[model samples]
Target: MRLSELSRRSGVATATVKFYLREGLLPPGRRITATQAEYDERHLRRLRLVRALIQVGGVSVASAREVLAALDDDSLDQNERLGTAVCALPHGKPADADDPAMETARRRAEQLLELLDWGYDPATGATIPAYGMLVTAIAALERLGYPCTVADLEPYARTLGRLAVNDLDLVERYGGTADEQVEAAVALTVLYEPVLLALRRLAEAEESRRRFGRK
Candidate 1:
């Protein structure tokens, strides 16, 4: 396909496609002439993934590039490749536990993980990428006098564990290549967070209406 055709098929502007090529987000097309380049479905797929990472996932260009690098790395196995990309995403930056509350929060996070027998990639430590953020958030809650006990969090943890299994099931069943798996994982993780939050808020509204009739 020509540049224009690729642009048309992808619904991304030609200039934007060119920008992605220049940024190395999309691979260079085969040069057919001094000015003409040929592209194909592979380019289209990559272009869409890049767009999803930046536009939909709200990742910075640098972070998206890092994820793309992970997808292209052939040395790592499929799981490692996916993990590298996921870890590269700019999720909540974990703050250093410098204060007493933060230190206490870290302890609580460790306890929750232990109670659930959860671990990060090391398979023994409560050191997932978002673990620090979890600790920081819990510290804030405690400081605000709204601390959640481990018992209060266990139900959510159990429910989300099931969700994780379902999420991975979708990726493994439909995600084709290693690159495709990474893309699927990133896309699903980024996209569905808002879905989860919206559902929670909507459920809260419903529960409130049931408990105390809406004004």
Candidate 2:
């Protein structure tokens, strides 16, 4: 397909496609002439992935480029590729280590991981964002005067662990290529996070209605 055809088929503007090509987000199409290039299905797929990352997943172009590079590295195994993708994705900012709430949350997070037998090194960059999430949640609960014990949070942790396992399984089994698998992982989280939260809110409302008449 020519650039115009590629743009039309992919639903991305020709100018944007050219920008992606120049930014190295999309691979160059085959050269047919000094000024003409022909794109193929691969280019279309890549353009879709790029759009999903930037538009849906809120990933920056630089981060998307890094993820694409990682996916394209044939030397990386499946686990490494997935790890690279996760690390490349956006994460919550880490809280200062010296803060008392952060320290407590770190300890609680470590305890939870230990109880679950999930070995994670605190120094790993991949684990930092997760730690930040844990600490933030814990701090929020504490500030609200509804601090939860480890046991109280364990069920939710177990459920999320199961969901995570299922998500990874689906990506590995159905995603055709490494790049596709990474894209699926990012898309699943980015697109479905709000859906999951909304479902939980609906469930809470339903439960309240069941316990007390809706008003």
Candidate 3:
């Protein structure tokens, strides 16, 4: 199809499509003539991924480019590709080493992973955004006098591990091709986050009512 067809099919404007092409978020189509190019299904899939990254995921163009590059990198295996793509998009706040709880929380995070036997690359430990985020969260909880030790977090880690597997199962069940799978992963992860949180809150409310009914 031509650019107009791609734009119409994708529900994105021609100007936005051209902008993505220029920004390299979406790959260029095959040049049929000096001025015209023909796009295919791959382009449509890519446009969907690009739109999800920017509009839904709320990532900047540069970050979206990084995510797209990571997703399209042929050298990486499927797991690595997904991890790289996920990490490429922005996440986590910067660490503050000066905080008293930071070091303790960091140590607890590391120890908790070890206790759970969750394998992770120590080389990438410092670079993984989740590490810093976990540390920050634990540290904040510590200052607030909340229980955030390894024992306190172990059940969450276990449940979330199962949740991650379920997420992958859903992705494979619904998504067809590799590109489509990546698109599904991004879409589901971002869009379903609030659903998960709301479910958790509702569950807690139900449990609280069972334990402490105020009739």
Candidate 4:
């Protein structure tokens, strides 16, 4: 496909595709002439992934480049690649390590993982940011006088763990190449996170209406 066809098929502008090609987010097409290049299905797939990362996932160009690098590296196993992608994402502000509330929350996070028998290591680059976010949220709640105990969080954790299992099962069953699988995992998370949050809000509203309807 020519640049125009590639742009039309991928729903990305030609200029934007050229930008991606220059940025190394999308690989260059085969050189057919001094001024003409031929793209293929791989280019289309990569272009779509780049667009999703920037436009939908809210990832910066540098971060997206890093993610693409991780995805393309054949040496990294699935877990490492996924970790690299997750770590490349933006995260909440890091709480002060010395803050007493943050300390408490960190301990609680550890306890919760242990109680659930989850194998995540907070020391890992990938898991640390998420664990840090969890601690920050817990600390914030405690400071606001709504502290959640381990017991209170257990049910939510269990439910999410089950959902995660199902999520991974579906990903495995989708049956793509290693790179494609990684792309699918990242795309699914980026695209569906907002949808899941919206649905949860709707569910909360319905439950609230059920419990506290006006007379």
Top candidate on TM-score is 4
Question: 1-215 in candidate 2: lDDT tens per residue?
Answer: 99999999989999999999999999999999999999998899888878977887788999989878876778888678767766677765555455666566667777887788776765773255656777777866765778777888899999999999988787788758766777677666666677789999999999989999756
The TM-score of predicted model 4 comes to 0.91
User: Where does candidate 2 have its weakest 10-residue lDDT segment?
Assistant: 122-131
Estimate, for each residue in 1-215, the C-alpha lDDT of model 4 and write its tens digit. Answer: 99999999998888998999999999989999999999998898888888888898889999899888888888899988987787777665777566778888888988999888888665762256777788888898887889899999999999988877877777788887877778778777677778789999999999999999785
Q: 127-146 in candidate 3: lDDT tens per residue? A: 78777778888998987888
Give all TM-scores, in the order shown.
0.89, 0.85, 0.87, 0.91
Q: What are the candidates' C-alpha RMSDs?
A: 2.3, 2.5, 2.3, 1.9
Q: Over the full model, what C-alpha lDDT does candidate 2 score relative to the true structure?
A: 0.79
CA lDDT of each candidate?
Answer: 0.83, 0.79, 0.84, 0.84
- Candidate 1 regions off by >4 Å? 121-128
Extract clashing residue pairs from model 2. Answer: none
lDDT for 76 (candidate 3)? 89
| 2 versus 3: better TM-score goes to | 3
Q: Using alpha carbons, what is the TM-score of model 3?
A: 0.87
